[model samples]
Target: MQGSGGPRKTLPELLSELDTMLGLAPVKQRVRAMVAEMDIDRKRRAAGMKTAERSRHLVFTGNPGTAKTTVARLLAQIYRELGVVSSGHVVEAQRSDLVAEFLGQTAPKTRAVCESAIGGILFIDEAYTLTEGDYAAEAVAELLTQMENRRDDLVVIVAGYPKEMDEFMEANPGLRSRFANRVEFPDYSNEELAGIFRIMARGQGYELAEDLETALPQRITRIPRGRGFANGRSARQLLEATITRQSGRLATMGDIAPEALNLLVANDLPAPEDSGVQQGDGGARRSLAELMAELDGMIGLAPVKDQVRTLVAETRVDARRRSAGLKVAARSRHLVFTGNPGTAKTTVARLIAQLFRELGVLSSGHLVETSRPDLIGEYIGTTAPKTRAVIEKAIGGVLFIDEAYTLVGDSPSDYGPEAVAELLVQMENRRDDLLVIAAGYPADMDRFLDANSGLRSRFGATVTFPDYSDEELAGIFEIMARSQNYLLSHDLRQALPAAIAGIDRTVGFANGRSARQLLERTIARQAVRLAAPDVDLDALPDEELQTLHVGDLPVA
Candidate 1:
């Protein structure tokens, strides 16, 4: 609901935007019907006649990245403009936000989230999780009760995979009745995805080479739309990875022209494995060489990459020794990753999972990211089972416990200790299958280890991620700019480094974090310049549109 009373895009224009979306023509038609119904209802109210009561609650069933969340945002604004709600804000929630481990906690949490959307929409993503157990059931009850009371002012939209959402609605007696306004989003076809790729690339100021115009669609069509196919999202990710590969390919070449920078040739499209693109998992896993090459392609983290290489080398040697009937110890799958913020710990952790999976160490490479808060419980006796459940969800792959040292609270009766005890038991019990990585500040992590004696032997490999250097910071900023279709002017290359040097590398020198913030600031400034009142969209040429001048840089 931007521009509430001011002149903004009209309802018809907004509807046109919806019409332009890649797939789901049926959803578009339904939305148009919804808008028409709202118009008629408003007319009836104006005529001083009694109007029938209607529920705005909706159930959006779709696969991942089919734009359910995007449409929900648009619907919120349309609801506000049509006088259906007050603010037209949208509050999004996941299962973790609503459900709690202990009794008497979930109602308040779910209620708080609903209160935030008092005059707007409350979107519950993966709402099927609400029917899992008694705790989530209590949350669902709270939600239904709130909706009953605030029928006119509040709108609720629950979304999930089609089958699971169906089961969820059928299992709950009141859910299906309340969410009668349902819409199902269909995944995009290969041709539609190819169109999405072009739109994304042009938005980012890059153009697919002539060969890619044909080859991209073929490759996109070849990819199986199975378990994890995300339609347009898959295409977007492929373009990003391809652009990164292009940058890597050009890094060794000198004197790249500005035109050459925006052109992505067929050579730039990354190989399937190197791009982390899953073509519905082949029976054979990625080779060790392929995984290693992907690791080498990452921008920073020289030390982390070296450590992985060393580990892989040691494991390879041990495999040979065992083949000859010599005694060898099992490779420790647990790790302690310590670093400051923006140090790429999470990214490296995910890559480690993938690398191990490639080498036949784990069944899957999915990284489950959670912290101590996700594992601990409010009540005294409820923490262990909650912690066990968290471990259970991460059986065959990596369980990355970020800021894990937070589990050791300062108070004596803190339930964090109970959670940690349960975690230790699970870590050893499933040591053969699961790989757990505990990550946080170096000192706090060491202290956490000192507190638990058994953890030291299990998590033997400790990898330290160093902060990015000033030059590396500049490189990161450039990469960010290039990825977004902006090429920095020569003056900004020098100006950016000077600005970064003045960023006060003392207490809060967020390395990659500061780089991203800087890039965003520059983009905002560039938009202010390019989008001046006199500029027209039709007249804006590609050259002026893509160039980010030194004036966009912050004053140092």
Candidate 2:
């Protein structure tokens, strides 16, 4: 053999470089494998074999903040070392950079970028944005031709949302075969995201408070449910937001109190603003504590109550373990509350926040509740930022999304799917400080999970809230009656069982929620009866307002 130089630089070297810079090991290993094959091809050419150069095109599909860009950069270095191209630079572009206004401008503009990235990698971020019009279509065609003409000299990586990536491939048949290597960057699991945040936090020289550290993962798991606006990008945004909030709080305090500076206290994270509540003008703003206290006093839901208590205990144990310098094991904090409308999912979510606080998982244990409409935006690019804003507010607390399945729809223009993808990403990234609980009809929820594998993987534990039994409905009715200070007469109590039993058998009845509605209707009927002129108002004491009889109830 000709003078053997020191053993060839292996693929692991490229992976090690990526791991050092970007903290992405899995992606690095993948790119390393690809690079190793390229190196093999290089040696074959050197030995005078007639093997053709293998194409280095890659397809990157994943939610944002999964470190696709970072890995892309490292791959460029590997390619340069393998002598695939002269310059080892990675040129990053998106639809905005390629598409042009004039009729003939698109091709030249696209080619210019390709030419500039010669002998290196050209990364197209959100490459699906090229699907806007015929001009963009032509631009993509030109891009493919460029790739073919310079196959050995260049590498192109196209990336975007998964569905869009599918569409992009379908739109260009030549591209499908050209991109031989496809790498899907899956959304980081809750535990993975927690680890990422911990790394970032530690690297930044911040000592996460013991209680806050313990509570972060549960908070992260609950973030994606109803909020349409968040995903992995939201997690990064949340971290940045926390940093900003912490900086602001620090600024306000003139003298740096040593204790305050040492501890990442409750005030370091900002409180979430309620979207449902109007601001500026005088309006009712209820505290979560008040809501939890009121809900605790309501009767029934023993199973739900017990489960909530257990969750609280687990959180406390985790917190204590963290405080004691013990490693906490990853467990799913996901919950599925399945009662019919008004069976206390919202109320329970509020209580869950307080439970988080008591267990040292949250600072204030506030609840930020949203629905599908809160997340899905009217346009394409707006969804990501809007969803991120909602998560930012819900940080350090519970982000409850009710009727979450509504975010998954059939239409490309629906924007619901976009919201879902974003939510998945954010859930992965913020798996420490945000808790997301999504509630909806059981069937719809299952379908939603099925639609996105990333979601199925992220929401590991789903607690189903079964419909209330007749007895439980009766208890709910009693709770509603007591709330209005109304006492059921002996006759009404006797009739109540029969009425509740009849309701339980009804086709469309929504468990205990329907029972509460019936009780409210009874209260309204009593009001209407009292308004009648025939009633002897003068003879009846004010306590009569608190009394309800069989006459107040309606026949089923």
Candidate 3:
């Protein structure tokens, strides 16, 4: 709170700002209703009438950059004006500040955070993240205790995506019971977003072109809107970028009038491809020849390579058929990659993501990698939402679930099955927009598929990544060493195959990983030998210093 000496905004002024906000009609309406209810309650109290108790704690649901925080800040001030809280200040925190990474620290951390917000609003952004594990559970428990104890003065606002917030409330019975005031913020419409862009430009003392308003909404409509889309913030970011471009354009001109300097035109705004508002073709553009060349250059996985080529060919053929007005049958894009650790399952998955993007099968070539622990939650009612969150992020590209076999379990109480069930639902719901690649050991993956009939049916194609041979391992080691600017001595090159052969072919032995580890160990040993006291470092040539001798190799 500012001191009495500083000027303050009155309740009407705060409400005016809230009402003038571009979008968020429901949010504005709800806020106005709350203010009206509070005002009537105040009058009733003056008339010696009883007032019903209402929960001031709120749950704000929306995507990113929907003015939730802005509204929260305004609501804090409004609460102070209405004598609901002592201070109009807000203390912002996420899971890290409240939840400890280790044991026993979460309660105190959470309590201290709540104590700081005793007289105002405690705004928790991405509150859904707090339902992850036992540590987060401890934070929620302490938060609930603080909310109950400081009911009079503190207003706790939890904000996140609509779906996750619902799951978060259900995760704890106390949370649903306490946070009764739910306000939803929807994504800004094209017209609302254009208005926001214009307001931002005007606020920065820049003038919009006469035609920009009409052109801006069309541009906004073209941008790919995914789960991570920032409705209001995207417009601001574009305005900033456009301002930079406008300045650049002005710099090249011989002379400019002072008034003309701040004027922006449609051409000043970056094209949709160049603006980076979404993953554009500029980043995802890759020739099929280049991708196939890179795949062929990999040390092994011939079968995997063939399978990938077939998938690409099939996608191309399907696209051509569709273009020619032929009805192409719907085919499953999901896949199961079976292999041991370090067999380049992830590497292949990333290549496939890029390939699919290039072929227009996916919107973005991005790859989201997750494991069993990342999807499954420690508590009940947590797994489905967590899995859906992962799927949401991977909508434009690939969801690569590594060691996916671990998602299958015999325990009835286990959350692994819950994650799998959610994956099946999201996989079907978002099939056209999402590519799911599940990778694990062959035997476990077979069992995983058998555990769920939907999994087996959805992932119709399986690509097998075989363990690299001794020769292939040697080739991989040489390529890695050379790529890092290190050369293998003649003697070391001769001993490489023998060293690779000596490695145990036990279950879960990392094939390519072993080769990488060997290279790293050899480099470390080389560094040690070079740093010997007897060695004159300055006298050695660059080649000698970078070479890997047989003595530098770690024993297999």
Candidate 4:
């Protein structure tokens, strides 16, 4: 294969480069198969046998930063080596590159792009965005015409997310016919990601310390695997951040060794809280490890936490299966969260939304909290729209219906059942992007599911949060007090277990809330003692004012 200038590369040499790419086994296999087909066609033509012309157009589907553009560029050169096209360069484009804002300019704009790549490859990034508007549709039509007229000289490759590319292909019959060849690029594994990081660091004259070489992969594993996770690009970003952090650390020291200038240690990696997963919608960046740490820090939800970890594992495996081009059965993402009040049900639901967003299962990951009132209506024929509005608001995230049982009332004429019916339909239609969580007390949740048989099938998993133990309740009190900048005296801490044990765990007891209420009362008592006439306000140190003694403990 001849280049613009320099030593010519052979067909085998071009293929060797493709094989050397890290962590794209499936993509490499598919490209090799395409090459084999091209070789057979060439031999058939040489033997004077007739062969039908095949479409050279290709579709690349996957999340960003999986090397789709990089592969396309190389594939163009391979096409040139096979005598499929005159040149092997690729013209990269997006919706803005092909579509014109004015009504009359779209065709000319689209044609200009295609003409520029007449002897090369036209690579459209996020090609699905063409179906988004009226002007964009005109560009698509022009593109199709050019693809057909220039089929002998030009190859067009469209790339985007898997689900959206499916829609994009369906948008035009011409697209389905022309782009018959498809290849999926999966996110890199943890090991591949670490290797990418090291490669980038070496290019910039930096080396990872021995401890950091081992710790890098572990750190990558903690990052949430999301649709926006730029597999290779993220590795580059992490390397840049690590370098920045190392520079800051070395600045603090009076003297730095020459060898230390280009070395990065484990401590140079960004903290878990700072290295966040960027959401699909470009919302706030939240770290998966930080969210998991928050969930783990909560008191006494061992079983519930385990269930969440299982969900994370499932999502990760499902992603791998899809990337490998395996047929994955469509599974329900909706869940049933059951427990009494103050068992961290709502808190857990919120965290799960953020977690799913980080895992690429959700787009926005924002939680929309609702109940019966938010769904049901006061007048007839109004319930469906109201319920739908709430579901629409939570399309790319989780819809948490607290006290979900309230949606099914005793009255046959009630609108609650109407809301439930609407919910059932919308949940099915939007299950691809939406996750619905029904939460309430254990018994009430059972009643709610039993009321509607459809609910049970949709909510395959149920995580029951048990009431907190007396010891756990004492821990909760301390956590709450400390959060408010108040300290418990040593004796007060010792008395907390006995005090918590005396509280009755009756219906509607609000297990965690009870601890909070006790803390509030103790703080009030401390305030009264501090204001007494015998106490010297000015002489009292700040520490004494912040501390709560045995006298401040609420009576059992």
Best first by lDDT, ranked: 3, 4, 1, 2
Clash pairs, model 3 backbone: none
Candidate 3 has what TM-score? 0.61
TM-score of each: 0.51, 0.59, 0.61, 0.58
Candidate-wise lDDT, in order: 0.80, 0.70, 0.84, 0.84
| Top candidate when judged by TM-score against the true structure | 3
Q: Which is better, 1 or 4, measured by TM-score?
A: 4
Tens digit per residue, CA lDDT, model 3, 396-436 = 57899998989988888899999999999878765655789
User: Which tens-of-lDDT digit does each residue in 24-121 have in candidate 2?
Assistant: 45565677677777777878889998766466799997667778887777677767777876667788998877899889999999999998888788
Clashes of 2: 18
Clash pairs detected, candidate 1: none
Ranking by TM-score: 3, 2, 4, 1
Question: Which of 1 and 4 is the better model by lDDT?
Answer: 4
After superposition on all CA atoms, how large is the RMSD of candidate 3? Answer: 9.6
Model 4: residues with Cα > 4 Å off, grouped in runs: 1-7, 276-556
**lDDT of predicted model 1:** 0.80
Model 4 whole-model lDDT (C-alpha atoms): 0.84
Global lDDT for candidate 3?
Answer: 0.84
Q: Which residues of candidate 1, in runs, are more than 4 Å off?
A: 1-285
